[model samples]
Target: MNRDKVVLAYSGGLDTSVILKWLEIEHNLDVIAVCIDVGQEENFISVKNKALATGASKVYIIDVKEEFVSDYIFPTLKAGAVYEDKYLLGTSFARPLISKKLVEIAEKEGAVAIAHGATGKGNDQVRFEATIKALNPYLKIIAPWRQWNLKSREDCIDYAKKHNIPIPVTKEKIYSRDQNLWHISHEGGNLEDPWNEHDKDIYMMTVNPEDAPDKPTYIEIKFEKGIPVSIDGIKYSPANMIYKLNEIGGSNGIGIIDIVENRLVGMKSRGVYETPGGTILYEAHKTLEKLVLDRAVLSFKKMVSEKYAQLVYDGLWFTHLKNSLDKFVDNTQEVVSGTVKMKLYKGSCKSVATKSPNSLYNEAFVTFGEDDVYNQKDAEGFINLFTLPLTINAIMKKEKNEKEKQII
Candidate 1:
């Protein structure tokens, strides 16, 4: 009898590699390893060979870097969605896209279930499962980390060893990492201790701040409708833009953050994230927005941004609220076209200057020098009207105090 096939989100890492074998051995299912490439540094040929060698009946290596950048990263960037004011939601948003691919592949292959390597304690479990459920509620979702007897990474390593499965991690250097076009996140091991300082050796895709060059680097980015279009006056595709910025920003030791964040599963987890390009893009974009957007619109958009971040972080990407917020974000982006010059030095990325065609800044009206527009006399009337409520309240309070003193 032919066994039922199950699609596995294979990353060629220890967790997913072991999960692939476990699903086949324990559940008697034919595992189809599906690797969705989002511009992470990986050898797809090696990943494919490893999956096949580890007893996967078949393997699919799909490149989705362009789609990831245009569809997911740009949308989040446009919304200015940052989780907890620190995390760029690199791992958060990728999970939904990965899960979407898993659902697609599972349906195409007529698979009965979709399996993943997300741990029971992390937010990824919720992110992956929520997207899966939203897309196709009929497919069964299998998460081995929650079901398997393996209590920890060590146990999983031992299981891999017994099964003769080649793994990526060792006990001495065990850090759970997720990488994509936007950023890379490191968790587990030393990071679990919030007090422990992350070692400089853990750095990838970036140099340490202390090791960065002494001189500062300057670059200009141009954006059209909130999406980055060029760097240094040269236009680039969405994926290429990120790659270029990462190279430039990484050398300057920019975009490294360490934080202890609350997980969706109701626990605190410490992780270090490196988002060189994304950090630069966010700074430049916000600088442009400040130049173009009105005071009230910018203030209200700040609230919407926080809510959008929560929605994405909580795995509500497919909901109606996020869709509505996306529309609002797009409407705001209409005037967000501009160029921003940035300076990068020693892990710092700052916007030095910005200009926009739709800028609200009026030098003629606010200039300190003598000008035709006479606004000096109008200020007295404006201030009186603005402070009317305060003035009235103070007068009433003084009169009431005088009456009380007389009676006493």
Candidate 2:
């Protein structure tokens, strides 16, 4: 007799590896492991072997790095969606794409259910399940952490050891980490305490700011309608662009933030995130927008940016409102084409110069030097018209005050 099949989002990490064995033993289901790669530095061959060795019926390692950059990362970047003004939403947006892949694989494998290793308390559980339900409502969702008897990472380690599972983490040194092309986030362990500072040694992709090079690194990034196109006059593919920037930005000790953030699960969690390339890109894009976009559009886009960030952070990527906001963001990006020169030094990435064909900054119109434009005389009329309502309110207040004094 054959057992029912269940598709698992396998990361080859401790949680998913143990969950794979648990699903086989407890649920009596044949687990088909699916690992979606979004440009994480991982050995795919090793991940595949580990999944098969851990009792998976079959393993599917799908490379979605290009799609992750183009479809997910770029759109968020274009919208200037930074969660809490710090987080780059690296893990946030990745969950929906991963869930989408899980659904697709579950359907193809004819699996009865889809399983994930996200814990019950985390936002990922919501993100993964929400996308799955939105995309394919009929598929059964199994959350092992919610169902299992294991209470913590310590218990998970014990289970993995008992099952002879090859795990990446040990009790001595365990930090829950999520890495991709956009960023790497570190949580768990000492990070649980808001007072504890993140270890400098925990950094994987960047150097400590104090250890960074003495000289600043300068680079020019060119954008086409808000999408980053080239660096230093050399064009690159979407994924390659991020990869290159990450290398340059990482070496310069750029983009590191440790924050106690409000999770969607109604709790505060402390995490340290490294988003070197994303930081550079966001700064450059914002600089370009300042040059190209008018005051009104830029002001409104700031509100949209906050909303877009919230939507992505909460895993509402597939909703109708997000689609509509994307349309608005895209419209705003039409004139956001430009080149930005960035200075990177000691963990700081700043835009030093920006130039754009669609720039709204008219040097002649606002220059202090004498010019034929004759803007000085026109300012009196403009100021009077702009302050009309204020003037009327002041006059009425004076008249009322005078009447009150006479009556008194």
Candidate 3:
């Protein structure tokens, strides 16, 4: 008899490794481990070997770094999608892409169900399951944390020990972290306490801002229709561009954010994120937009950016509304082509200059210098027309007060 096959979103981490063994030993199911690489630094060969040694029937390691940057990261960057005005939606957007791959593999392998390592308490469970359901409603979903007897990470470690599964996490470094091309996120352990300041050792991607160099680093980033094309006059592919920026930005302590964000599951959780490259890209993109976009359009798009951020954070990427928002964002990006010069120092990326051929800024119109392009007399008629309703309201109030005085 053929044992039921299940596709597992395996990361070769402790949780997923334990789950892989449990699915085989306890449930008697054949497991196909799928690991999607989004630019995380890991030994794919070791990951595959460990999964096989731990009981996976097969392993599939897919490289999606380019797709992740161009499709997921760039769209969010162009939209300026920041969760709670701080988080860059790094982990949020990664989930949908991972789930998509899981579904695709499941279909190809004819797996009856899909399993994930996301804990029930976290937002990732909802994100993974939502994407899975949206893509394939008939497939069974197995979330090990919700159903398994292991109640905590400690228990998971014990199980790994009992089964002799080699894992990466240790008691001294128990922070659960997720990393990719866009950013690195730290959660769990000491981060659960709101008052506990994150230690410098917890950060993997960036140096501490105080430890950064005294001098600043400057770079020019060029964009075409909101997509970053080059940096410092050197053209790079999407993945390589982010890799280079991550190196430069991390050296200068460019992106570090500590946030207590409201989870989609209706709970507030705190996490520290390191998004060196993404931070630079977002600042450059917004600066260029300011150069090209009109005041009203830019203001309204800021509102749209917030909504778009929420949608991505809430795992609504596969929906019609999100698609429509993407179209709107793409339309707005048509004029968002330019180069922005920035200074990176002590965790800050400040735009010093920006230029775009589509810029709406007219020097003569706003300049105080003598020029025939704009006449000062034009302000008189404009102000009168603009304030006509206010003037009428004041006159009516004065007349009503006079009538009241007569009555008195």
Which candidate has the highest lDDT of all? 2
What's the C-alpha lDDT at position 390 in model 3? 100
Number of clashes recorded per candidate: 0, 0, 0
Residue range 1-408, candidate 1, lDDT tens digits: 999999999999999999999998999999999999998899999999999999899999999999999988999999999999998999888888999999999999999999999888888888988999999999999999999899999998999999999998999889999999889989989888888999988989899989999999999999999999999999999999999999999999999999988887888889999999999999999999999999899999999999999989988888899999999999999999999999999999999998888899889888989988776999999999999999999999999999999999
Off by over 4 Å in 2: none
List TM-scores for all candidates, in order: 0.99, 0.99, 0.99
lDDT of 3 by residue, 75-143 (tens): 999899998899999999999999999999999999999999999889999889899999999899999
C-alpha positional error of residue 170 in candidate 2 after TM-score superposition, expressed in Å: 1.3
Q: What local lDDT score does residue 309 receive in model 1, on the 0 to 100 scale?
A: 93
Q: lDDT tens digits, residues 193-221, model 2?
A: 88887899999888999999999999999
As a whole number from 0 to 100, the lDDT of residue 211 in candidate 2 is 98
Residue 402 alpha-carbon offset, candidate 3, angstroms: 1.8
**Scored by Cα lDDT, where does model 3 land?**
0.94
Better of 1 and 2 by lDDT: 2
What is the TM-score (0 to 1) of candidate 2?
A: 0.99
